[model samples]
Target chain A: MRRERRRVERADDVGPYRLLRLERDGLDAGEPGQFFMLEAPGRLLPRPLSVCLATPAELAFLIDPVGPGTRPLAALAPGDAIHLLGPLGRGFRLDVERPLLVGGGIGIAPLPYLSARLGGPPALLGFRTAGHAEAAALLPGAEVVIDPVLVTDALPSGHDVLACGPEPMLRALTAIYPDAQLAWEAPMACGYGACYGCAVELDGRLQRLCIEGPVVAARRVTGASTMRAGR
Target chain B: MIPVLNASGCLDALTAPDVARTLDAYVTKTVTPLPREGNPPPRIAETDVGMLNSIGLANPGIDAFLGEHLPRLAGLGIPIWVSAGGFSAADYAHVCSLLDTRAEVDTIELNLSCPNVDAPEEDALAIVAAARAATVKPLYAKLSPALPNLPGTAAAVAAAGADGLTLVNTLRGLALDPATLRPRLAAGIGGLSGPALRPVALAAVYACARAVDLPIVGVGGVACGRDALELVAAGASAVAVGTALFADPGVPGRIRAELAVLRGRVPDPGV
Candidate 1:
């Protein structure tokens, strides 16, 4: 609930994304699917980053430097002080037996932790091309799938699915697997539930992704186009 | 004494009950007569000193709020100040009449200036007078900083039976994306709140405090105890924490502590 100024321990480029490992004292070993709002100097709002990896002393994030909020994070160097507020949001419900983790592109950010929590379940990682697929190497033993085919096509039946990626992929996956739990991203003003800036329509009501979940049941979600547009 | 409360829509007490408990009082987001879906994507964008938002007052209608949210918010144990907003004076009176019967409701805050909505001219006196006739509970008018004559407006609302005033609301602003050169917010324009609006808030409080004898709840861009003290020095009876809540959920409690230390250090002026 408190924001802390943390120092970046390492910053490296992984294919099209930048991975930054931060050294934070009193850092919680956050649950898989939880995220932190990372703030750099000069930026107005902190960017929400899913916990790619978390340990007792360090936390890592895989950031796509596509927008203004995220582009500045790529320039962070070791010893740079970055503000963090987190381990926020309700993480994945890890109560099912034989759970399968599926990730597309940078949506793969939270899967490495989800996989570790599941005792390393076989994951299906999808990307636009082989170059972008290189980031899948961070996931140890994920089954890599390239463009023209979706990871959803290869989804096995009867296994509990957990997914995060672009809206189309999530929308497509949800149609096939209604019970799957999904991690959603919106243009969140407050990574906490205070402001309804990141609200998503679900079952005829608006739900805040920061509070109810960045991770939510796929069947409850509506208006995939709105989510895709990052409203 | 009500130390500090969060302005309406700034903190969602239902989701973060623990954080809600830390505040002196809880202010629920603006609730209208009918449910609103709010604006489209890119509803919020960060500015150089503050943030811009076009949330469109997205909230469940009064029926659901009273049935679902009010009970849960009352359970938080903090005093609940229900913020009511609508397109007409009748709408304000309608909602106030309903809340008047609820024992759990402590006060009513009339949101008169939601920049995103298209409504007829804001008649603060008419709204306060209508709500005053509907509810006996204390009523406060949350006014827009953009009002051309704040002091006269404050006097009119007070005479209309408003018990207090919330100094200022967010100022309308626009941001453009560098690459696309298009508006950054989907709503094209959004209300600005943060450190940027502090001076404007202070001026409003100073002017309104001298013009009217009613209590004023100062709110704009208070992120710390020092900021709260500044409003107090400007004649605000109490301050409401807004944009700062996003950065620090524990800010209200922290500001309370800081205010105590600040007061202790101030030399006593001869009475």
Candidate 2:
């Protein structure tokens, strides 16, 4: 159903990013790290922001203030109105074994919810610097390894990895464990599969960000772009 | 306030099995008078920020359209804005006269600036003249963002008696395939949408708004309320979601809600 999702509830400073929690009544069972397209109040295009957490009654997004888009997003408070088309992209995949979860900066926001979905304990996460402590803190049981120099060598090997963050971090992990499952972030043209805008090479084939995988096997990413992404 | 989407050709609104329930507005593919299957294959190509289309106004003739398809779209609540094309001005008028009689249809949109089509500018003017001569209902002219002196051109259309203007259809373009020594899309060209077309569409709306007093329906790359609002602020009476709606059916509704929020009014998303 094409129903507009208005922000009925909101909270500020959830760890590092300002979180906008939208409540819409429907059959939306949004998965963790899955995202929604929020129509920025008066912009020409909708920004495809990532979801930090999800539930049946409500869905949540953790966004940092930035650009013309995030500026308005930062100013929004409870009772403020916004529209969202959600649960649109494919999210994380938990293989139930050796899940070496990793995140960076605001990208780390998805970790906690992802951990909860994994149904168990701590996983190793590497950040760019110690100042980025908030994201590491949000995820329960995080093995915080600060300092960039040791990153390539310090990551504990021998675990199935699930990671989301800037390109550099993912590139590091991709080289380490090419077989580990990786969730990628790509710009979305349409959350539906029509435009072929948000495509990535997956196993020598094309995959659409809106339909194929915001989440995919670590081996599938070719790091190509056909469209721009949302927040 | 009316719920109408853009008639950007081959948008494939008929993607899902059930078309009626999916979109409130169903714009017919741009139709010419005779059976024109359109430009050769490899019709759509790509560009840096946007894409291009060279469909050549493919259609199965106006008679077949009315006889075979009109009944299927009848009783649908939304207005069927026929984006009409013609070999000459008389062709446009002749087709509009035929379409206006059907109670289910009312507005006739004249295609003035399709880069992929063959009609000349004077021919478009004549068609508008013809449609004006033929029908009493409103007639809208769809224009290009690329044409030199767009505002002046729009003013001319308004003076020529067009009821409204749809600013900027797909900008002409091409996309090459490195491996195939050919274009990627089947048509060799296609209309570019998404973020790439936003600025051109905006400029067109702004120019047209300043040029004429007629209501303008903004189109191109609107995927949010802010985009729509920009067109409104630029003098567009309405905006159309061409690329976005086909990509995400729920975008229009979401954009509507966000628009309510931007105005500080709590949106009642009566979903």
Candidate 3:
């Protein structure tokens, strides 16, 4: 709800991604799966990052250096300052009795926080390689998978699924877990619904993903698909 | 004092009411006669200097606006400017007539130059005249800066009964993915806004202000107070924050504060 320039406490490499830790500075870490718009230095547009971990004093983001927007975020050194605005968008409804966290690649960014909110629920995380799988360290007790083997392949039954990852994985998960909670991503300009830049066709309607979701129920999405990755 | 408004489509007041309260008047996104799904995704792209978007005028249409959005916005206690878009002159006039009775609508801005849609070839004069005849509310024509005869169009629209002008909608541009070498936006091209648009917008405002006597709301890449001051110096009666609102919703208040500080340093030119 506020925009502040929080100083970077650390930017450590975890496989091919960066674990960016910033001083919390009065910003609320809202519900798990909610995202912040991180204004990457030197980039015209800010990139949306879900909170990877939130200690009382610091908020951490797991970033993959995918392209122009995220490379600078991954390159930030300690003592650098970055502007961020968020705790925006709908997050997971943590009312489930038997919660199961599912994530793929960088989508694991939101799972750690979500797990904490769900009182350390079981997790299944899938990455592309052994190096990429190193990020699994953040989710202490979660099972890990690499590409050629999807996390959906190992999905356990009868648990309320909370998921985030690439579009393909989400689509497959939604097909199986009709009541699952999924975090989706689209290229966004304004993380609040103003710009309509994040509009995705859901159930034959163009819904602004920023408002209806960074997290949404699986049944609400019919054919919506996104090429961009991350939560 | 000059008003600091948000350019149409830049700020959704319902979602960000606090940001809307910072503006002198809140301009709604372009609402058409019918609901539009907008362009396909990959709709936004970040350039080296600014941004490109092909949103295609997505909205809930006027019926939904009056029934749902306007009533909520009325509670915000700020003047509301409705941005009307259409495929034809009648479409513009029809929307204007529909809004004529709504007391909450303080102004109607005819979006005659949305680069994302296939706009009609009818001149601004025709669209402005149609809207002017349809509604008693003050009408402001939101024109594009990419026009070949911007000054002439401004003068004609003014003579046709436009009360004011919002100078410069985004100019058309394209960004491609370096990996694929294909269009970055699914729509193939998009309207460019942000810091790269400041000069083009200033030129439009400067030229139109000289050609017509109507008050102008200058908008484009206004990110800071200096940017707003420059627009005023170029003859704008008011300034609007556009793409910058995407990154910083607190922009209108910041620019206003900066403008207040800056106005003291510059000698009064009696603009």
Candidate 4:
């Protein structure tokens, strides 16, 4: 359906490449690890975006404006006919009682939402060299990690961590925790799990991230890389 | 005539409300034996050519589907093709056996690409074998584009007694955040679908048509009537609008009206 949500609502640039918030009063159907395919005019391919927060009336996605689709999506005004497909794919599972939040880059979008859902937990969040308003604003009271030294210093002793973002950061965190649930991202064609393109390994199984997980426990990943068969 | 919509799971439940009003055949999401929560999110990822996804079989189990969503769907005034999947042959049989008894369900679409949830290394044939033993209804197995031997798989599926086929599922792809320099989606990988996959889906359709005699339902990147016509030229009896449906909800209805134009282009079967 040509949901002119894009036409009716424009994405407000929140921070750190994050460029969309479904400006509805509270139409948040999104979940952590779920994404949106942002489509604007003249852009054939929709931009893949992640939802940081999703309320029944509000839906928020943080994206880096990169190519034709994203650039225009970033330029959307307060109300535009939106053509978006989401809360597509699978979302993170916070079923565990104690999930130590671990975030890297804008992947931190889902953190506060998860924290809110999990009712808040002490976390270890990593950012780049400088501070990002989106990250700082979204993640309050969490331990911040800017470098390896910080990650080394910040990882807690017993709490299981749930992380999303830079592979290096996730890898580093996984090296530290080794058993944390890592959130991953893969390019997708169908938000449904038919395609094997968005595939990753978990406990030696080749499962599509869109369907099986954007989150897999640290111990299940066999390779340091995402996608590709153990290659 | 009632407009035949893409029986494949094309329209996301969240599309514009008008889309529901406009479509002729809106298929439901793939259902399974027990309710499936689906794969974890970071479900979608971007790519240079298109997008990818891995929404594992997330659907309310058959009982819940019959008790809950079906009533709402019945009111839609369109034929519903119930898409079902399972890891093994036995599992497929069980699910279809359940769906076969449901009233709102008019047809069954077997997902050929669902890997085992408990053991994810299995192939598509197990699903085919299961659906064969499961139901006598109009059963359609949705196949994948990236399969190693597309025609062979289609032939094998036909020999296994498939009623029809929905050719081409997503091709796996990926994207990343340059600033953080990491993968863009949480799953790290996703199924690729869009215009870029049109040729792949078409090729599979053409090959499978010659390989086997069952009606083929072509999908992948159908955004317009012209794209749908192209699938027909390649050998599809019908075309499914998957990714394009997200962008233009009315494309299916539009494609249907334009079918006569395609008939004009094709050589008469009698000749």
Provide DockQ values for all models, in the order shown.
0.52, 0.07, 0.70, 0.13
lDDT to native, each model: 0.85, 0.66, 0.89, 0.66
CA displacement after TM-score superposition, residue A54 of candidate 4 (Å) = 22
Q: Under CAPRI classification, how is model 2 graded?
A: incorrect
Task: Please provide, for model 1 over A75-154, each residue's C-alpha lDDT reduced to its tens digit, 9 standing for 90 to 100.
Answer: 89998888888888989999988788999999999998788788898789899988899899889888888988889777
DockQ (C-alpha) of model 1? 0.52
Least accurate stretch of 10 residues (summed lDDT) in model 1 chain B? B262-271
Candidate 1, B168-271: lDDT as tens digits: 89999998887788998878999999989999999999999999998889998997878888888888988998888876787898899988888888642211
Which has the higher lDDT value, candidate number 1 or candidate number 3?
A: 3
Question: How big is the positional error of residue B70 in model 1, measured in Å on the Cα after superposition?
Answer: 2.7
Best candidate, TM-score: 3
Misplaced by over 4 Å in model 3 are: A229-231
Candidate 4's TM-score reads 0.59
Q: List where candidate 4 sits over 4 angstroms from the true fold.
A: A1-38, A45-68, A73-231, B1-4, B12-21, B115-126, B257-271
* CA deviation > 4 Å runs, candidate 1: A24-26, A96-98, A129-131, A148-159, A228-231, B120-122, B266-271
Residue by residue across B1-271, what tens digits does model 2's lDDT show? 4353654563434332233344445567777778775554333333345445555676668899898766665655556667788767877877888888887676778887777656564644566777888888788999878778888888877787899998878776666665566766555555665567778888888877878888888887787887877777677777777766644576666677777776565343221
TM-scores for every predicted model = 0.91, 0.58, 0.98, 0.59
| Shift in Å, residue B98, candidate 4 | 1.0
Single-chain TM-score of chain A, each candidate: 0.95, 0.85, 0.96, 0.81
Error of 3 at A55 (Å): 0.7
